[model samples]
Target chain A: MKVTKKTKVIRSPKRGFYDKETIYKILDNHFICQIAFVYEGYPVIIPTIYGRDNNNLYIHGATVSRMLLELEKGVPLSINITQTDGIVLARSAFHHSLNYQSVTIFGEATLVTSENERYKALKIISDQIIPFRWEEVRLPSKKELKATKILKIPIVEASAKIRKEPPSDEKEDYNLSIWAGEIPITSTIQNPISDPKLKEGIPIPESVKKLMKKE
Target chain B: MKVTKKTKVIRSPKRGFYDKETIYKILDNHFICQIAFVYEGYPVIIPTIYGRDNNNLYIHGATVSRMLLELEKGVPLSINITQTDGIVLARSAFHHSLNYQSVTIFGEATLVTSENERYKALKIISDQIIPFRWEEVRLPSKKELKATKILKIPIVEASAKIRKEPPSDEKEDYNLSIWAGEIPITSTIQNPISDPKLKEGIPIPESVKKLMKKE
Candidate 1:
């Protein structure tokens, strides 16, 4: 992957990573992403779910959604996936920062037109949200698929920025008797709440059981 | 307070909220935000921390930061703050969704030039990350303040979209014996890890201790 001027991290150059391994690692760990595109000379951002498979990223929304309609026109897009790791507490207010891993991709999305490809893309997105659940649950019917629009963006130009270390305070500020450290933050999955209309004897599915075990 | 065309939520109209109370509640709970701005005819998105005070949202960066420099030009900007509450697992893949609260603000940001306002904005940002830590930590000095730039965007044109209920499966799919529910997700603050160079006798600060207590 080439580091284009747009994908390069201008601030904190040292934290910028251009390698595919680093970019994919951050993208695969998070499901939500914010995509930016120019609309009528103004920038617009839409936060939505995304799935990455090999060198392509997929996102699906209702066919009539404004965002999906605009993106399907093959407009230039900037997508960002971020995971906040912790809050860095420094000895001074100026030095406070966050520990995070984020990836930004620059590309244009093309509408997935083929029936087979659309189905595959939808499955990839479903799997990204909950692995193995796509196989367990009912698949999308032709009517449902028709109402959804899927877009695929080639992940050729991307970069990752990461900050994982403890807070670094000014040399003199460290002696100010202030306690400085890192407060780790994590998104944890709690017990599943069954739908009120669920059947009486149905137990938790295997995919959710596996997810709980991982947690 | 007006729902301008830019800030109106076009998708899932029922999920959109225009009330200030709902917007402010979502903004007050989250600090990280993604800001989009048009640069050289292309849209660029940057993820950063922000603080909301009344009708203005403040974000700061190094004086030389590209994002700050570009945004200070008063270009139109779109900022989004999203908090994913859970993953809604439905009986069918097409119905699976995420439970989240997100607020999007469409406006222009101006450079904060006044010395007093700059200092106060920085404190609000710091307090947003960790309350009470601003009082304990060393304040920014003249040079440090000069080295940073802050931009304030009005919160007038904003809307929030939220989804908190359980998954809604199709009428026939609900009887398919598949497990359907929501996996609640929460960003938890873990125990603070003291900096390696911390003084042995210094204890954890009150701000962090209080944050942990709330968790």
Candidate 2:
């Protein structure tokens, strides 16, 4: 819950919180993270899936991946994950906003070298994509593990900005004849589609079945 | 859709594209863009709504906003927008992935100077948030315009990566008795909530009603 100068939200003080529990919930709900870093003086952002364990964030890329190489250099970076919940329609356009849950973290990512750590991080990332899928599938082999580069980023400075309430129009605009409210948004997971190349006689795993319903 | 050295996707060449239409479609479908830029020594990213006009990308912030000020400085940056469609459940953990649509662009953002251009950019942004909402509400006053800063970034280099098909497991892994497939995901706009303070005789606007059904 500690706030750092970098993680503080200046514009909307009421909506920002540096609480660890709040930040973690947002991160855990979304698998993808937009990692921003300086690459050759240009700011580059890559959307990659991630997994979380306690305070450590894990991401994997090919050993030769440019993103992984840059992350290993330990340049200070920020990772952001956001989920849009609704469109807040206001009487005035200026007051219009989004009902979203977002978390931004500033940290340093290092290449995970230890085999045990790398193995665990890999499983965590897999499970993050589809909960319990890690144990359902075959683990990585030595060659696969070697070819993959996993990085661990410690959550140092982070903040969550969430706006879930109804629209707050200007006092005078309340008299205007405009419909003002929130059109709620939600992500729905449809039924699972079996892969064409799936082996015959294989039953749909419970893990994949669980994904069909809301988490 | 011009492909520069940095905008190209190298790891999965088959999944990447540099066509203007493809990139624009992805951008148009998503409203939030994760903008990345370097500040001092740290790389920072912020989630902001954006509007596209031909080849120009416009984003607004408070005149004193750190993101806007830094962007106006003309630092090289990348904007990434992504939509996750499904969870690709593979037979092996290493091959697990997400069926996603994403676009990344590299450009230098410069502050809008002319008042006319600023006004138009603001409308484009408003409409981008909710189509046709710009005309429904009052336009910004002179003071409001001056207090806000808008930056335009030319999409000189961009690429889109989209995967919408079923999972592709390893040839040998097809023999495993684990389910291999995709759980399609979709973001749905729920029923609109009328503001508690809405004035009498005010009806729900057509724009808010249109948002109820899919576009």
Candidate 3:
């Protein structure tokens, strides 16, 4: 929620910024996060799917998740998310970089305990992967709820860094006449090949069908 | 270089001990990392390129990198790298998951100072994009070096979480008629399109040319 720090890199300074709108933009686009926390004396990092609801971020895994168990104990945690836009091929090695937007939220995450919030958190996390599928599928039973743990971390201490544009080079290098620019890259889903054993004549849902039209 | 206290995560009672070698394999294949750290009073995260050398991980950005600067100060830092292999579609929402291999490293980073080590770090970071290009291109000049800051954080505290194969469903759900399985995914680069203004007859380098042949 606060923008206390930002960076200025010469080759890609324009790409770095500290703003809520920019941070939210990047967070909304990515569905996964790498959660880092110290376990014992060493740093432990884990990747998990995450859902952002208002100011709080929710992440969950099996009740037996080692990282989650340690994290649930109120260990300090850092969660990071990123989206790659393209590859920048500068005229020089030093000038080369990737066009990306990333947000990092740092804080100690508490294990969610309220039963109502826990179920809601699970619903939000599931809906993130496939909207409305939660309603279509049978809800979790009491045992299932007890077997899963969801951790909620507030976005109170978060910042965003972004980079976009053609490469930056010294004037002298630019004059040397080497080609330089960005090769835009994107995460594109190919045609959805249905499961071999999919139900006969079951039309692809809108969510699965959505990926097919994207270039 | 030791996988000491600062780099260890709780050994999960279940789904643990896939081995460090297997974890490293996943880390090596990933091209991006989301790093989380505290900046001032807030937590900020960013995504950037990273390379591993022995036990240390090297990352670089502008000399004024905020996260890097905060990280260089030995503050707690969390990093996560993930490779998405496929999408798991199941008969029920609770059983749905992803086929992925991800590693999260948590710990404070130490800035690289030795000229020799920095040189090697730069090479590793660059080679991740194209292996031989480090030799093909010019190295950073003294001024460039002065303008850049590189940090080496040992991958001591780390853990890899992975899920493979079809969905896991309750015994009862298996009997209920519904579809279940994985939808594989991968990142592919299309044929390289040369810059429109590329000078006549500058044969594409072997590295660039070779990428074209990959599907």
Tell me the spans in candidate 3 whose CA falls farther than 4 Å from its real position.
Answer: A5-20, A38-42, A63-76, A107-116, A190-203, B1-21, B35-46, B54-56, B62-79, B105-114, B153-159, B190-206
TM-score each candidate. Answer: 0.98, 0.97, 0.80
Candidate 3 DockQ, CA atoms:
0.32
> Candidate 1 — which pairs collide?
none
* Candidate 3 colliding pairs, count: 17
Candidates ranked by TM-score: 1, 2, 3
Q: Which 10 consecutive positions of candidate 1 chain A have the poorest summed lDDT?
A: A3-12
Candidate 2 per-residue lDDT over residues B4-55, each given as its tens digit: 7897778888899999889989888878999998888888899999999998
Best first by DockQ, ranked: 1, 2, 3
Q: Relative to the true structure, how large is the alpha-carbon lDDT of every model?
A: 0.91, 0.87, 0.69
Worst 10 residues of 1 chain B by lDDT: B4-13
lDDT of 2 at A112: 90
- TM, chain A, every candidate: 0.97, 0.97, 0.89
Q: What's the C-alpha lDDT at position B139 in model 2?
A: 62
Whole-model lDDT for model 2 versus the true structure? 0.87
